[model samples]
Target: MQIPVNQKFRLLSMLGEHISMCIIGVPLMGLSLLTHGNWGFYFVLVLYLNKDFLNGRSPLKRLLNTQVQQTTDVPANEWQCFLRNTTLIIWPLEVLVVAINGRRRLGDYLANTHVANVSEDIGSWKKELAAYRVTSYTFYTLLATGLYLLLVHTLFDWLGF
Candidate 1:
């Protein structure tokens, strides 16, 4: 089945949210690793899940003014939030399945969910670009710097230089 434009918009919003999470997550992961070592992974996971659970949207999604709600219900509750966030655990596999299936992912199939265009106006390139610029400059810049520092430290430590 052909995906609707709104669904496409939702997919874009989801991608934005994931990117935003990575931007914030990687830096925190770096800090956690530098301080506590392996605990960083757990910290990142908890942070990602909790943020998503607290709001139906993440920082990126919020910037875009998009939300992820259940298709069956008007307003998704805590259980749905938990389930939705938990799905991230298998998100990679889910994406692989969706790619192979040509857009019938587990999340879409199981939840009977479809991402809708919640933004008052859809197809605003200016808005999307502005959001991207803000997210990139603020979050991604920190993530890049942190990763660079971590990489340099690891390399020097490994090389004994």
Candidate 2:
């Protein structure tokens, strides 16, 4: 299939990188359980709250050559990186968003960012990270976490768990 959005992030590439990142959670959860009991779930939760787009490219995404950038022509900021990743808790919806719309994912809209063509760079994330709003970030992060827990509980309920 053609790479969508003029060579932004193809569906398979995006999914592959995310799935690969999830793989790392296995060991994290195992270790966290041993040391932190049920808090292990929190340890593994970072699998969704991605910091890769802020600190550095995941080796996989770099190999795939996908870059996240702001739609407003500014380099992506720290909040965007975190908020964009948090939306992966609803990854199924995001997949549908991309596969049907042939456009940015749901998280991209939440963060006001997009996966840009390979030629585009997000610029110094280190510097961008320095610019953050603590109140808003914490508030939204809690909101995202609450939504995640609600979704999980709803799914388990629907399944009679």
Computed on alpha carbons, the lDDT of every model, listed in order, comes to 0.52, 0.62
Error of 1 at 67 (Å): 1.8
lDDT of 2 by residue, 4-103 (tens): 2442355776688667766877777788778856455554565456544443245565665556667764446555767777776678888888887676
lDDT of 2 at 107: 81
lDDT of 1 by residue, 1-161 (tens): 21222444554555666777788778877987789675555556555544533234445655665544566424233334434554665777766655565433466566454433355453344564454423233453345335544665576679995
Clashing pairs in 2: none
* Model 1 residue pairs with clashes: none
Model 1: residues >4 Å from true position, as ranges?
1-7, 96-105, 108-113, 119-161
Best by lDDT: 2
